[model samples]
Target chain A: MERPTLDQIWAWLDQIPDPEIPVISLVDLGVIRDALWKGDTLHLKVTPTYSGCPATAVINLDIQQHLRANGIDKLVLERQLSPAWTTDWISEKGRRNLQKFGIAPPPKDGEHGSYGALLGRVVECPRCGSKTTERISQFGSTPCKASYRCTECLEPFDYFKCI
Target chain B: MADKALFEFLTRIGDTTLVLGHRVSEWCGHAPALEEDIALANTALDLIGHTRMWLSRAGEVEGKGRTEDDLAFLREAHEFRNYLLVERPNEDFAVTITRQFLFDAWHRLMLISLQESSDQRVSEIAEKASKEVAYHVERSTDLVVRLGDGTEESHRRMQHAVDILWPYTGELFTDDETDRELSDRGIIPLPSSLEGEWKTHVDGVLSAATLVRPEREYAHKGGKAGVHTEHLGFLLAEMQVTHRAHPGATW
Candidate 1:
């Protein structure tokens, strides 16, 4: 069998969806920092969305299993935590996918702000694209999200919180 | 260059987060609302993760065989170097928020300065922690305002919590010889120097919340010197029991 290219491995990884938000792939989430093949071994770098995200372990396991099934057995997964992960790293496609999946995408370049920004910022409802939404809580079903209610749609949704 | 000072500094930061994180974790499943339950638990998890990072690095620097778990679970209350403010009992929802708000504000300021430390590892950790602490500050500030300025009953409870927690805040900025040594080397900022910014930030939030700053008096001190309130022992007892009972047991 011809050796699979680095691009091919990434393609395989793209098939593995995030356990929490199954509609989006790990690549879309921007968690997969890098993937490189070093001779016979493949080295992968991953950054979690949050320092304490419980889903990190599950995501690591899933990556290993998915890549191993593709016959690339020698793998090294390094968790790079420096510079920290930010919501701005979420791929454009990931944001769109998250919105389509009923989770509001965080604002781009919303990297630095004060408490006032959190209170005053507006987030459109993912379900209806209605600009009328209010945050119910700064927390949601996951660590990286906030709970918001769409006044127009009368539906509750998660807003991928800006970190 | 004294390694002891460095070790002590690392432990001071680590133990504060570990102990306070344990306190925050206690609110899990018990918060007044579901959103608060998630928020507090999430904050606890973040603090615990930070504890592991700092302690693991401390162990490496100390050239000790102790792991993060060893430092966390094996140490007794007297050995801990956390601030007295953090080790206080979580008396109520109001108290928890009050404690968290004060600590979060100070923590963010400290971390912001630490990001410029001569120690690369410390700076990197501080950078990451500063971001998390910013969110924590925002969350706690919002809650403090909502509770303090909302109903009259809530305002009274919040005021009471502030009165109880305020005395302990002084110890957070009290620098000793170890802190002075580290400060001289630019490895860490003088804790007292950060007090000005802390006061400005904290006072603003309190004023906005329609809460009065408790009158300053004889402030509690000595947690950094391994002296803590009566609450630390019980907290450590409950926290350390499982690990002590089953040594080296892992699922």
Candidate 2:
């Protein structure tokens, strides 16, 4: 029997959509922390997108079913609680994917300088890449996001709050 | 006696969280800012989660048919065992922040001790809650210093809140027979031991805020003994109404 590769595990995980945000896969969300082959069994470590998030059970179930369908039967799912999840964990590709999917990605830290001086910040529109944008609400779709409206495109989008 | 005692201890813990969570939840729409509001609400949610866990465990240990909801919502004013510190109304943002600072300081220490509890379930819950409490303490301490030293009016209000709440702080360190048993068996740490650490952390923050710990001769007690202030009944009335009115109803 040959050892399974990371690519194989990644491909298997691609089938798992975020339970809360169905449009994105766990891999795209950067929540599939680690994958390893131990003996004939595969071990996958995942972190919840948010603390006390209710979607963890669904995510776990999805991962197990997806891996099983991909012919990896022996599986163990582990949850890492510490170090906490941050918006920075979302990858560049994930950001692009999120934008294309009509959900705005998290803003880069210090991009707006200090949150203390809030008005001068230039938030780029996720849709049209326009630099003119204004905050709609400090809170967005979830506790981890803020609502913003693009001045140029006039489309409202969610900006994942900096953890 | 043993079963009743266990139920009482568990209820004390649950009621403390429930009442404090209720008070904290009021900050939801009225916090100083959106971020602070979210933070306070999240903390309230965490406390409510802790209350559910402990109350459910209490129900199991009691061998009573009562579920967590029954214990939470069906209980009368005198049935609650929450400390007076958490039962106090949210006077102002300063009062809320000061109350939180004091409670979080004690809770952080208590949770740290509970993390090593011999009871595996207790230890597990404490381990998780400790992290959250640590953050709560940090946030509270930061706000205390900022507001205390921020402006003349802010400083006066912060100091006044601290003075008013200091009397309630002593009761948290007063342990009863249940606490004694749990501490002796390593199921929980001694409340007295946690007091020293709590005091050190609290004093450090107070000093930075240029606030002095008030010297009070009378410290309130008896919450753990099923005695609470006039506030508890009203709070419980609001919290328990829905569940008590519609028994065992779940959506």
Q: In angstroms, how far off is A60's CA in candidate 2? A: 7.9
Task: List the candidates' TM-scores in order.
Answer: 0.95, 0.71
lDDT of each: 0.88, 0.76
Task: Judge candidate 1 at residue B248 and give its lDDT.
Answer: 98
List model 2 lDDT by residue over B1-251, tens digit each: 33665577678877888889899998888887776787778678667767877788788878867788778888788778888999999999999999998998887777777767777667766665654555566568888998998899999999999999999989988888888876777776767778877888888899999887897747899888888899888888787778777877874
Give residue A47's lDDT in candidate 2 (0 to 100).
71
**How much of the true A–B contact set does each candidate keep?**
0.39, 0.02
In the order shown, the candidates' DockQ scores are: 0.53, 0.10
User: lDDT tens string, model 2, A37-149?
Assistant: 88898888887654445576688988888777777778888875443455667778777777887777766673321213333456677789888888765544454455789
Indicate which candidate wins on DockQ. 1
Clashing pairs in 2: none
